[model samples]
Target: MTPYAKIRVVDASTGRGIPLVELRTVNGIRHVTDSRGLVAFHEPGLMDREVFFHLKSPGYEREADGFGYRGVALTPRAGQEARVEMTRVNLAERLCRLTGQGIYRDTLLLGEAAPIPNPVLNGGVMGQDTAQAEIYRGKMMWFWGDTDRTSFPLGNFHTTGAIATLPKGGADQGIEFRYFTKPDGFVRAMIESKESLPIWVSGMAVLGKGSNESLYAYYAQVRSLSEIASSGYLKWNDAAERFDIAQTFAKDRGWRFLDGHTVQHEGYILGNDPPNVRVRADAESLLKAEAYEAYTCLDEKGEVRRIDGKPDYRWQKSLPPISSTIEARLVREGKLRAEETHFLPLDTEGKAVEIHNGSVHWNASRKRWIGIFGRKGGKDSALGEIVYAEADAPTGPFLYAVKVCDHPKYTFYNPVHHAFLDKGSTIYFEGTYTAEFSGNEDKTPLYNYNQLLYKLDLNDPRLAHAKT
Candidate 1:
């Protein structure tokens, strides 16, 4: 009967009705016209774009434009319906539509323009059927959620640190400059060392649920007690299957440790080979699987360190070489999914947005939310505030974290985006810090942005806490 909607068509030569002729897209969609040569398809969303539709039948040279085609483009900030027309194809034509493309920079309204969707109600419930662990007074929620069916937003925080890798011999475990993630989604992780001034950063999805749990982190600015004060980029190529933080300059840098040295290390023995073992396995497997390989490493090691013997590899040029580290993982409940490379290729916009802070401490006593701190000006200033939304279930239409607020500072950095609170739970908050009136760079942005992290005080009417 009727497959979709209806449109009109006319014969070019006879200027008469081309009744009964089949209409569809060249990609093999079929539709039938009525007595007036009119037919329709079932679809929407088209504006300022072009499209192609085809006409089909048992063999006459098909005409594409004879039936007249139409197109529509995409709106930068809104969604709209795209009306189109189909033309006959002499050589098998089809209907097509175009979409608008460009960079969109605007102040996203809290309840209206929030970028991330609420996972709890959006069917993004992760870790539903897997083992879940709550640590630090529910500050850290761990579960397995299915991201494939859910919508998750990502964030990028820049920082640096060191990653130690254990080689074939346990004697050598060296550390490199890198970055990682904080439990609270900060891109800064301290190594608890005064002699080494390195920081860890992360770039990954801030909010996710179900089996789709994933994060990307890195350690960087790795240096000795003396040379630690410098702003340089460190590029690391994971293609070498390198893992564990080892000292390439030390005598035993390349060696692995077979026995335990520290009390914490006493338990993990044979089970632990070296940091790079798994990475090497992965690199080899990938090399054997794919016809091509891609990896990069910066000369930022201070001293170029190369392991001897058939280290089992080849070398490739390091693009944007910096002492950057990537930590990627898929947590399947308590079980960890295979660790994949963390550094993702730049997007069409050429901006690295998501980051991870693997070592960030979550002080629930301090606040239920985490604050994302960034410089006031420069490219980072473009970072908007975080927002959170909530709904009753995984299929809910979510509401904003802040019901109403127009203040320039607090509202600017207000928590408005959603992040995974746990496997099945999530919270929404905002980033972006306001400069202090005192003009004190560090202290101002610190207090302004850092203090943004706070629990939804039930008594606080300013926040969009659970109603009723």
Candidate 2:
């Protein structure tokens, strides 16, 4: 039994009691708030619990307990009063697939890299000789485990396999196929195999860069062309393990699929045809505002403009694409220097740039930054050498960052997350280690055993760091 609080939940709109409402918590406990909108619990175990409210009367819809609701921190004290209200819920308007806590799918697959001391190397499971991968659709996000080529005849028994996790709380592991193709937005992986066996491949989206310490995956299952008509949505789970909420939310209402390229939904398709906002940084607050002198080194070598003839200057609002002429006014007598734009490039166009999480500050040590790049070729993961860049600030106006890993014919290396240890000036980046799959490896096709994390000395000079 639970003790009830003598509280009243009056309707905000009608000012009437919302009688007999049941409240539930995330931990599977339920209590009822009375006609006056007051519900009480005897125990306060976890402060992190989220509560939900439901009414037993008609015309009243479910509600959630918000910050306004109060609970004792584990004492016999006056708890906070909870208010309840009802709103109409349209069955057709489901929660967004990307929103909420839900499971999408799960899959079983093996992960491996070359056995060499370095994760990147040729003639191994993943062919890339460097730690990098490119951003291309139809590329495999992860690969199945493969045999150790060194073990020869015995290695024959150890084959490779792949798996994909669907969005609806289910997984397809150990797919029985040799070649797999994913048509954007079709929701299913098309399989080409050695035998006519029913093969299934799990589908998942990688949430962040390929080199992040770990890939956060949302598993999704296939929705055949037939199922699309009845189920107005397609979905993937949070962890690619279980189906919890509708993944498509509302996007599926107007959905279409292209043979090889786009997944059309809500009048939009996925591609890089033109200039759009590809990447954005977190909003940053301005520290201060000021103005600085402008210059022109042309034949005259003089000021660009003058306020009143005395070396005119103005306070400026500086952001990315710092090569523009946007200036601010100096309200005070302080010298205003332009804030240097700090950003990382997304592609060759350099249109979409994001801020780099600064490097670790070393208390006592010299350091360098190594850049490795690669691309997927045919079936192998071909890679370039490790480039180098050095800067006092991890966020840089880097004089020279190595493009040692640049291979025009190969895909550019996709660097995930990087961490610099200020204590030792050591830097580490993790990502999938892949190269062109030569097709000579047994059992597994192209993407067999394709994940690896690379570590390097940030202060190493052989691989020169970018000069400031």
On TM-score, the leading prediction is 2
Per-residue error at 394 for model 1, in Å?
A: 20
Candidates in order: C-alpha RMSD to true structure: 24.6, 25.4
Each prediction's whole-model lDDT (CA)? 0.24, 0.26
The lDDT leader among the candidates is: 2
Candidate 2 TM-score versus the reference: 0.26
Residues 41-137 of candidate 1 have per-residue lDDT tens digits of: 4444321333345554211234334435432121211222222333332211111100000000011111122122220122221111111112212
Stretches > 4 Å off in candidate 1: 1-198, 201-217, 222-419, 422-426, 429-451, 454-468
> What is the per-residue lDDT of model 2 for residues 367-396, given as tens digits with 9 covering 90 to 100?
433222222221212432223444443223
- Of candidate 1, the 10-residue stretch with the lowest lDDT total is 96-105
**lDDT score, candidate 1, position 356:** 17
